[model samples]
Each structure stands twice: as C-alpha cells, then as structure tokens.
Target: MALAAVVAVTALLVSYREVALSADGLRSQAAPAVQDVAATRLALLRADWEANWVKENLNGVPAAGESYQSQLSAADQSLSRLAERTSDDLGTINGLLDSYGTSITDGALYYHDDRPIQDQKFREAGSLLIRSDVGLVPRLDKLQNGQMDRAERLATMGALGYTGWVVAELALLVLALTLLSALWVLRDRCGRDYNPWLLSSLVLTVALAVVPLLAMTVTQRHLDNARDKLTAITTVAKQTERETKVDTTDARVRLDGAQTRVSKTSQEVRKELSAHEWQNSVYYGALGGGILVFLLPATGIGRRLNADYWRAR
Candidate 1:
C-alpha cells in the first residue's frame, strides 16, 4: 500500500505538471502571437468603421476624432511593443503588424484632417489590414486551438491522477480497517485486546488514506476551476474571431451568424466543460473507491500468504 501510494503520487505529479506549463505557455507564447493577430484584426475593424463613418458623414464632419484617435493610439502601443520584440523569425508577423498599423494610421490621419480620401485610397488602407490578416489569422487560430487542446489533455491526466490517488487511499483504508477489526477478533481468539504494533500500523494506514482523499478533493476543485475558465475564454475568443474576421464572401453574413452564436454557444460550451470536469472527477472517485471496496481484501490475503511462506521456508 505504501509503494502504491508513492506510484500514485508520482503519476499525479508528473501528469499535472503540464497544467502549470500550459498556463504559462499560453501566456508567454499564445498570448503574444494571438494578441498580435487580434490587435491587427481590431485595427482592420476600426479602419473599416472609420471609413464607413466618414462616408456617412462626409459633408457634416462629426466630432468623433477623440474617441477614434484614442482607439488608434492604443492599437499603436500594442504594435509598438510587438516591434520591440521583432526578429528574423518574426518577420512575417512583424510585417503584417506594420502593414496593418500603417493602414489604420493613414486612414485615421486623413479622417482627422477631414481631407478627401480618394475612393480607392479610403478602401485601400482597410483592405490592406484585411489582406494582411490572411497571413496571420490562421496561425492565431492554431495557437488558440492548441491552448485548449493542452487543457483538455491536462484534464484527462488530472482525472487519471485523482483516480490513482483514490486507489492508493482505498488500499490503505481497507488495510487499516481490516487490521482494526482483527484486533477485536484477536481479543476473542487469543485473549489479547490490543497489539501496540498493529494499533500503530492501523493508525498510520488511516492517516495516509485520509491525506490523499483530502488532497484529492482540493485537486479536483482546482482542476474544475482551471478547466472551466479556460473553456469559457477559448469559446468566447473563437466566437469573437468568427465574428470579427469575416471572409470576403459574405463578411456581413458570417459576422451576423457569429454574433448570433456568441451568447448561445458560449453558454453551451461552458456547460459542457463544467459537466465534463464533474464527470471526470466523479469517475476518478468511483473507480478508485470501487477498487478499494472490492479488491482490497486480496492485498491482505497476498501479504498473509507471503508471510506464511517465508515462515515455512
């Protein structure tokens, strides 16, 4: 039982190691990559918004420059940060960011000065932001999907880890209970009410068993929390991408569909993630608990047989 406890612990520690790494990797890797894409997409969206606003109010020149400039400046900061981190390896993405920023900046400038942007020029900047997006969006999609994939894998491993914990704890529990029962039986059979060594062993076994059970309860809660949050964020981001990065063929239609799906889809995804987390934890408990209940006596029997064989030899 002690050896089994060690194995169970090792399995859990090794398996859930990736959970921490996944969180870190998403922040360090996926965040930068995907945020760049998102920022560019937002720039595209904003540029389009600016163009549309101008065309609608060309004669009036409405007082929207402050809000529009604020958005552009914020986007510029994001791009500027990306620029500071550029390398040969990041040339593709760097170029895309630069082009996207240029389009947004130029359009904002023309709109700010209230200069007439020729028909092609007005659309050209927005079009470049969109066109440049072609090279970047898919990579961001992959990174986004990859983060969730890692999370799912961790959830599976966490479930398995909890299962192992349960199994080891059950073995220890049964061993403790049987020994405690044997103490009473020995009082009837051999006239000894207690054996100090047996009492000590039983106490130790129960302590060990209880520890894992308690620890696993906490572990399950953490797994549930991380899994649910990651799922919610991933779902929302995916839906947002679908809405914001519409393709040339029916961008409006796709955007509308994506917008419509956001609320319902996010709710459904969150529900599924929550249900899955609960199911995995429950299974971990059941399988671990059942094995302890049904098969633990065999451990006792095997130990006794080994002891007897050594004595006979």
Candidate 2:
C-alpha cells in the first residue's frame, strides 16, 4: 500500500509537470511566434498598398511616404522578434526585405523624371513582397502555419497529461481502499482500535488528491481560453487581408482593430500562464506529502506487528 501510494503520487506530479510545460510552450513560444508572423504579413500588405497609391497619385504627399516607411519599420520589428523564437533560417527573407526597400527608395527618386522607370521599380518591389511563390508574405504564412502546428501538438500533449491524472486518481482510490481494509482487519483480528497514523494518512491522501485535481482543472480552463484567443486573432488577420484589396481605409481600420485584439489577448495569455509558476513548489510539496503518507502507514503497521511478535515470544 505504501509503494502504491508513492507510485500514484509520482505519476500525478509528473503528469502535472507535463501539462505546465505544454502551457508554457504555447504561451511563451508558439502563440507569440504566430502573432509576429501575422503582424509581419499585415504590415507588408499595407506597405504594398501605400507604395502603389504613391505611384498612382504622383502628388508628392509626405503622408503617403511616411505611412509606407512606418509599415516597413513595423514589419522589420516583427520579423526581428520572430527570430528569437524560431529556429528557421531567415537569411533569405531578410535579404529580400532589404532589396525590396531599396527598390521602393529608388522608385521614389524617379517619381518626377521617369514615370515608367518608377512604375517598374515599384513593380519589382511589389513582386518581392507578394509575388506568387517567392513573396515575403507567403513565406511568413508558411512560418505561421508551422507555429500553429506546434501549438496544436502541445495542446494534444496536455490532453494526454490529463489522462495520466485520471489514472493517478484511480491509483489513489485503490490505495485508500487498501488502507481502509488494513484498518478493519487489525481492528477485528487484533482487537485494535483505529490506528491514529493510518487515519491521518487516509485524510492526507484524500486532501492531496483533491487539491491537484482542482489545479489541473483550472489550468485546463486557462489553456482553452488562450487557444480561443489565438484563433480569433488569426481569423481577424485573414479577414483584414481580404478586405485590404477592396478599400485601403477600411483595411487600415481593420488592421488597427486586429492589432488591439492581439495586444490584449497576448497580455491575457501571459497572465494566465504566469498563474502556473508556483506549480514547481506544489510538486515538491506533494512529493514530500506522499513520503509522509507512506511512512505513517508503515510505522503504524510495523508497531502493531512488533507488539504481536513480542507477545508471542
């Protein structure tokens, strides 16, 4: 019974640790990486549209030029942040971005003198950004897809961890039953009253079982919420992309709204994940409690048996 109790405790602690790690990966690594890629795509699309507007208007408007530069800067910053989390080689994408910026700058220089050349330059830059196969936007889409896949896998692992928790609970139930049976046998055969040590172990075991289960339940809830938020952000981003083709002003409005949602949801995810930081301490405490639970039963039964042996001698 002591051995069974120890095993159950170890299993529960291990399972809980797995779940915590999965949540951390999703919150700290995968979700943010996805957001970064999405942001990069949106920024690049807006910049492309602004460059075209500049070419068509030929108004020498400072606002349009500034917007274009601002979007490029935003895309660059997003890519830089993504670099920290991803293992993918970004050398090619960075090179393309540099070339794209140069073409845009060169095209602006020819706006007054050579209209056709300026148009050609802008076309080259646009192709670098949204060309069919080699465009920066599509590449970022592929990267974001990879991040989404990773998040899905982590979520699956968390589900499996919960399954492990169920098994641990079953083991705890069996341990409780065994302890009760031992107490009853001692009372009937040896005319012993309820053993204090065994009684305390039973109570402690029940408490331990309930506490971790409650924690797991709460963790699962937070995980689900974070996932839902990520999904919403992705959907909004896609809609913004589609709408950008129809109206630039409307697209800008949608992009701003999406950015706000992303920012708020990201904060919420971090807060939820931070709640599990204390889990390591809880794990150690539960381990120590399991040892105590085992010891209590062993000490009680050992004393009773020793007393009987001495009486026989």
Instruction: Name the lDDT of candidate 1.
Output: 0.49
| lDDT (Cα, tens digit) per residue for candidate 1, span 1-313 | 3454344334444333334344334334433433443444344344455545555455235554444455456555655554543332445555654665565445554544554554445566555444443544454444446545655554444565556655655555556666767667656765654655455556545544564355445554555555565565545546655555554455444434433444354344344333333434433553454345334444544565576689779
Q: Give the per-residue lDDT of model 2 (tens digit) for 1-313.
A: 9668977888888887787788788878888887888777777777776677676675455555777788889989988998998898888888888898888867864463577888788889988987876888777777777888887776565456767888889888988988899989988977999999899889878977888778767877787777776777677667777787676776556766776776777787677667887767767777787888889999999998898899999
Candidate lDDT scores, in order, read 0.49, 0.79
Among these predicted structures, which one has the highest lDDT? 2
Give lDDT for model 2.
0.79
Return the TM-score for each candidate structure: 0.53, 0.90
Give the Å error, residue 276, model 2.
1.8
Residue 90, candidate 1: C-alpha displacement in angstroms? 5.8
Candidate 1 residue-wise lDDT at 306? 75
